[model samples]
Target: MSGGFFRGTSADQDTRFSNKQAKLLKTQKFAPELEHLVDMTKVKMDVMRPWIANRVTELIGLEDEVLINFIYGLLDGKDVNGKEVQISLTGFMEKNTGKFMKELWTLLLSAQKNSSGVPQQFLDAKEEETRKKKEESDRIADEIRRTRDKESRELEQEKLKKMLASAIIWVHVLYLKTAVGRRCK
Candidate 1:
């Protein structure tokens, strides 16, 4: 049974994966559907190609569950129209979004299960994924802090400007009053 599974043909699996890829493309609001580009030559995968290649590379190297978690993190990290994309696999499942994450889960699990010789690069990718997650979290925290600090500074500056303006106006009024009195005397 195991041997039969192994010989089930990569072509067939590729076709199945392709179908899911098409569906994924249609669902993407802003991102490019990356899975569909697998059949293309390496030269064709240019900068214009979306992060799907990176995602798949990461997926194939890590644990199935970890890969899913990482993908969810990526989806969440994306600020589409300045709003975070929070549709994780669990969130999608809970909300009954569609077959999007379901297919993604299948792909990851299958990739892990079918591999006879897992590459050392996969281990490296796992480390990178962890590092990236930490970096992203730290970056977000820094951004929030920076925004708050900037707002605080701006508020202080505005208050100082108002006080200076008020002082100048008071001084001008006092000068005018003294000048009028002297003229009358």
Candidate 2:
């Protein structure tokens, strides 16, 4: 049983085989080719599609078609497939039109609340109206807090000055009383 390919004390042969296997595994990893399909920019999105879809379903309870439509709109109507569809964005959105429009509008509005272009000058004014209202609210809150803080500090300083003046006045009164008593004596 000891005269086969692994006979006798062949430490050099054993080490050589182990190195060869290590090198083979290092050069030829057994990972799926899909992981490195494109750039790393969308690797997380590709990997987490299932998780995102599950969460979207849980939050919205949308049907499969509705979910697909919503996702389609979110991707700006671009096909998730490897091929790039040469259709316009408006056309793409039109293709997925259904009851999902309301939900898509809500989603897009929320996303573009902070930043994004409006459809027209009138729409820009409307968006600016909301932005200005929010900014005014924040400014008013900051002003109120700053005023309150200033008043509180001024009141504290006034109290401290009064206490110090009262102490000095008490000392002067005590000195006067002492001087009058000593004079009478």
Candidate 3:
């Protein structure tokens, strides 16, 4: 995921993490349908974290039933639903509205992997996620309101300009009529 707005690198293993990458991702704007980027070479769904996987594609197709006979990509030598496996996130992309949401989950999951601060990060992530969402939504709403107000003000000015022009034209026409009447008298 070493792409735009994503700050991961192959050399990240040696670098000490101060949660900068996670913070960047969290603060970044949501990229729509990022899962379907054509030129962006994506890490396979097989590499997806359990957090994304559990929501994106379940390893088990059984709704409430436990996969008592599970193995690597196999359940008793047969696929889930006894027909085909549905483990790929891309396979579910057609109806998936929350593609970027999965990316957020992935980034958060990576933040904790192999780190001793997993517990603290996890707790903070949950609380911070909701708080951040509220903040962002509020900001966006305010921006939209300001924009609409500005547009309405512009529109009112335009209407006033047109009315003023029309009134001036009418005034000139009436004055010309009275002047012509006086000359004829």
Candidate 4:
């Protein structure tokens, strides 16, 4: 569909509205009646509900009541028809998992990059995880270093034992060769 009806404030490729919403929306400056305003700020979250809806359906299991609660939470407690959300609002996300994950990452990254009010708790948690991982890696490195001398000593002893055994075998062969030569003479 060329999407002749239901204009948007932005020059975005997509209209960012459902078919019903598009019909209700005013395409031109002159509107016969007052209609619902398109909150461009929420365009991201509004699109997210349907985008990931199908992939998450399996996660919800057999609970119908859970869908309502889930939808409510998904909409941030916005008063919306649960049936509309269930039927048409979900599954707006890209179906390919890898692409979907990357898209979601970009979406979140854009939000964080653009916003000044990024939560301090998120930054704190990220720093904590990095510190813990670095400590674990350092502990392992120290343990390996501590055992290096002991391991090297044992390895050197093993090499000496193999060399001694080889020398004994060569001596026995030489002795047998001389004995066989004397018997022939």
Best by lDDT: 4
The runs of at least 3 residues in candidate 3 whose Cα sits more than 4 Å from the true structure, single-residue gaps closed, are 1-121
lDDT of candidate model 4 versus the reference = 0.49
lDDT tens per residue, model 4, 45-102:
5435543454345444433455534544644532332223333323532233234333
- Compared with the true structure, the alpha-carbon lDDT of candidate 3 equals 0.46
lDDT of 4 at 143: 93
Displacement of the residue 60 alpha carbon in candidate 4, Å: 14
lDDT of 1 by residue, 33-78 (tens): 2222221122112221233334444535433555445544454321
Question: For model 3, what is the error of residue 2's alpha carbon versus the real structure, in angstroms, after optimal superposition?
Answer: 76
Best by TM-score: 3
Q: What is residue 70's positional error in candidate 4, in angstroms?
A: 3.5
- The total of clashing pairs for model 3 equals 0
In angstroms, the error of model 1 at 170 is: 0.8
| Cα lDDT for residue 61, candidate 3 | 38
The 0-to-1 C-alpha lDDT of every candidate, in the order given, reads 0.48, 0.48, 0.46, 0.49
For 27-88, candidate 2 gives per-residue lDDT tens digits of: 63232321221222223333234433554455456545565444544454322311121122
Model 2: residues with Cα > 4 Å off, grouped in runs? 1-128
Question: What TM-score does prediction 1 earn?
Answer: 0.33
Give candidate 4 misplaced runs (Cα > 4 Å).
Answer: 1-118, 153-185
User: How does each model score on TM-score?
Assistant: 0.33, 0.31, 0.37, 0.28
